[model samples]
Target: MIIVIVALGGGVAGGYALSYQQAQQSVLKTSVPKELAPVIAAYETVTNNYYKSVNTTKLTDGAIKGMLATLDDPYSVYLQNNDKTNLDDTISASFGGIGATIQQNHDSLSIASILPDTPAKKAGMQVGDVLLKVNGKDVSKQTVSKAVAKIRGKIGTTVAVTVKRGSKQATFSMKRQKITVDTVTGQLASANKQVGVITISTFSEPTVKQFKATVKKLRKEGAKSFVLDLRQNPGGMMSAALSISSMFSKNGQTVLQVEDRNGAKEVYKAGKKLDDGFKVTEKTAVLIDGNSASASEITAAALHQNSNIPLVGEKSFGKGTVQNVGEMGSNKELKLTIAKWLTPNGTWINHKGLTPDIKVDYPAAAKITLINATQLKPGDKGSDVKSLQQMLTALKVGSVTVNSQYDDATQAAVKTFQQANKLDATGTADQDTLATLAQKLSAQLTKDDPMMKAAVDAVAK
Candidate 1:
């Protein structure tokens, strides 16, 4: 009588929330354990005899969390309203918002990135602008999730956001729209135009469509081979993985296998229709890193086993369990592990990841620490300050000491960077300054990505 929401492209296929009748029926069919009589008595005693007022909602949520905590499983979680909404948005890959990703560091929430053609970009919202308020309500102390929930709303509605950039605060009122994330992006390799590199960040409903179009476009542009990069990809929809695998597999070929606790198994096969009437027969090499998991592993295993495609880069993140998300009333959700999944060869990669056919590690410099401070003054001292100093050194803004302490030399270097980037010449590294530094560092990393090089070399033959 347990409820389950089948994962369809990482999202629920029908209504998200369970109906009252369904919940009632499930509860009515199951008899409450007589062993819980003492637990119920404890609840009555606490509520009836407590000296101060109590929030029953918090009590109930805590009880639910405690129950889940006993399972000792990280995947099974009791999600609050905002957390549930965020997970749903991520799975669907679409949401009604200004289309900006936010990040929080040391109690400061700021814009991490902005999607192109979105209301946030149109309204001139720049990265690193520290969020101050939403709709005239102060949200400076709220968490990133709560603040984001405040920003997202029904499509066509307006949300006013106030952000602090440098020394001034600006408020922008913009209409929210449906922001569809592009999970798949492809481009012809600069070193070899005949080789196309496609990166799948995450799997979602639009992933298959986007992948099909990308393949078609690359082939039209004279790309004879492809490097499918799944590095840093935390897997999403199982449906997307199956559909994408079908593009390189024969019709009716096995893509994945699911087994429940009862030892019963379900076989998932590739469909010709899911291939969009075409087969990608070109030489393709998959690039996986330690972060690639679930759907990413499924696609990699399917292509490697079925088409004999070589896998390059490091081993994948092993995640072989399947989860079913059931929506509780009041915007809450219970995500529980339901079954285990196996690769095409019947290997369960629960904690042991797939070994790459060719392993290539990135350079040590690729592990550069990110700047996590909202601002850094001359007296500040931490790893973040050290990172800023290193970035300033790499950019050749000015000669500064690489020590963790932010001294006068660091301030001068920051000022020089600000002036060169056409920003306010503030000696302190502010949000805007930090964002610019991060972007510059990212560009350098992309140019020297060793994994990309290995992937291109593998498939460019």
Candidate 2:
């Protein structure tokens, strides 16, 4: 598909999302001090004596941003109208745009992910594919924001995008839609029937609700233990994180300790208000990686501190400050870093990240070719059988051991899976059956998903 790269109309945030909570706050109202006479005089001079007509809104916005810049905090900013809209979309997990995350690579803009069920994913845009053009406009030299603006348009409008995947180039005509992003996904594991896994992408407004409902459903479906995966999750909502942590922790357990400017501290504890019904099994684990930040770190710290869940994977991205996004008049916003949050044990996780209880690096995927089979009966034996077994195991299908042998057990599992998937049940692992299984099993894990396996092992052991 030839995706035309064009010059965009507006700038876009790179994978923008916000972690925010609206609560009863005590605002210390202050009058404008006399120290700002110089600033007001400059504004008056520019408005009155500037050579041309001035945009007072732009000037005021720039001035507010300039004042914030003196604080040396990147998170604190004066949000313009568009910036506020983006933040709102991020917090709500719904936006009107082509749902694909792009990152600037060494030499090109590469697709990082295509949001599920979105036009980008439907058009078969794969991760790591290099963007060639948008609507025949070359985007090789354009900034990500500029490129994104060009890619996004009115709902139902079509945009052509060209990308280079390996040695071949393809173009796709994709329509913009109102995409609702799901932050949490879950599944039962084949390696261990007792364990269910949940991966959290971010802590949006609805994330805690999703987490509770999915986990409860998993429990009802016979999942005894659970693995909470927070790898690559650039965190959102502090309140959401606390809510999730409360499910695992007992009442009165500390969720966070906020230290304000004057060294005053405020401790947030897990209350007994929410009773997430599942009895978190003793083997429950929390997974973390370098990209896990803010609220993710909070959740990890809370779970490990109170429930003693084994945190598995690499160290997290330490971002412990709390930012309060306040409405600045009309459509403007002001995100100010009000306090620094500490872990339950009073450890400050600023630039220094939290260490996992079981620090295991990701293992390499086993090299295996995707195979097609007509029908495998009880007597089949080979690498193909082993590959099928591996895939099935990752999907948490029935007890088909990866021993390179298709026995009666394997056939039984195949029949059950086919029946559940609404496929013709011939008690065999055929090509169509395997493809259907792949679709259902893609998000849970792959044949060689090292982290998923580690999580399963951590609990199973």
Candidate 3:
């Protein structure tokens, strides 16, 4: 069986360990050949002569993983029970967790992004927040997969998390719930009403269906052109990608090419019947970024090649390979890098990813929230002043204490903020300064994205 998925996690329950042991027993019976006598001798010696009580099951699993590791293939990995389960959940586009995307960076597992309205977001978790501790146990040294397992739990169960945001450490206890990820969402750009923006979080079984529905809704709501946003999408099912691409491509049109290890080639083409629901007259721009990988690249390439849709934003993540997950044992699955994904135009998009037709450098400024107006010159004492101080602190303004009273120090900080933002250097917190602060705060919170702005411009008649 072939399945595509993107996830990071660790072991499951003890049942998996037993299933793995049984699988190893079966493998030992047949997989090793007579030329591997040395290996068999080593295994027997370790089992018979080792002084400590050795876990033979773990040793066997480790041996299998060690053999695969010698191939030096990053995509090939030992899938523990939890890893398999996580893959399944990712493929289905739902799981029980706090709804934060985690990635292993240089030295730590940090929050790559937070899914809006999920438990993570509800708990005020922000992107780049480092996982400090889980349930009071320091997990800074744990792998991304292991940390994810720690964070995930049964629905409605609460997990305590300590996150490090710069020098500040905040602990939060949040309830875990089933997170249903919306792969496709559409909204008419507020800045350009004629241009609709459809953000595809990833390609899953439900993605194509959601994309079709969203596009239809946008069209009915007077969206004349569209932007397909694939920024930060880590990719999912290949079938989902192709099916979604068929919406914009002609029937029987070549969408992608696949070349396996044995040099066998296969071309995937749109079916005999196309999705006529996708209005051809509506121009499209696909938004891509460093996180756009695999199926996301396929969709971007297919649309750009077949329909001349302009690609906007940064170059893609360059993960243009297909992973086929096959069953190893009853409950164990082995994922192998089966094929390299080729564009319809026969470009091999491997390590060298697809470059966007239009390169747009959007500002990565912090999100801003519009704050309530507080007209205060000085000698102000109230909760509003404290709120302003908090907002100022978030903007990295220095020395603004979170006291309810606003003194001369508060005025000086306000002046500094105004100067930095290129507004009039006013010493007082007036309407203009408050409005500017609100706008700056609001900038950090703009989820619509500036890439959509460039895309709208490209499609605007």
Best by TM-score: 1
Residue runs of model 1 more than 4 Å from their true location after superposition: 1-30, 52-57, 82-145, 150-180, 273-277, 377-382, 396-401, 405-412, 426-428
Model 2 Cα lDDT, one tens digit per residue, 1-461: 99998764433211111100111111113354545655665676677657899999989988897888788886676655444522213311343576776554334566654544566655545555688899889997565666777887777887877787665565666667886666778889878888998877677777888887788778888887889988766676788888887777777878789999999999887775543443344468888977678889999998998888888889988888998988999867788899999988898999888898888775421223334354566788976687677767766688877788988888888888898889899987765675565445554434456777878888887
Task: For model 3, name the residue pairs that clash.
Answer: 366-444, 367-444, 367-445, 368-441, 368-442, 368-443, 368-444, 368-445, 369-441, 369-442
Q: Supply candidate 2's per-residue lDDT for 280.
A: 48
The list of candidate 3 runs beyond 4 A from truth reads: 1-31, 85-97, 101-132, 139-178, 272-281, 364-448
Model 3 Cα lDDT, one tens digit per residue, 1-461? 98987453444334344444544565578865545555555576567557898898778777777877786675665565444522223311344788776654334656755554566755556655788888789988676677887888888988877788665565656778888676577899888888888887666667777888898899998999998888767676888888778777887789989988887889888764434445344798999977678888999999999999999989997887888877777656567777888999889987888898889765533322222333766787775677668668766686888786788778888899988878778777775566556545544545545666788899985
For lDDT, the strongest prediction is 1
Clashing pairs in 1: none
TM-score of 2: 0.63
Q: What are the per-residue Cα lDDT tens digits for candidate 1 across 110-183?
A: 77555545677555566567999999899887866788889999889988788887665656667789986876
TM-score of each: 0.72, 0.63, 0.68
TM-score of 3: 0.68
lDDT for 94 (candidate 1): 55
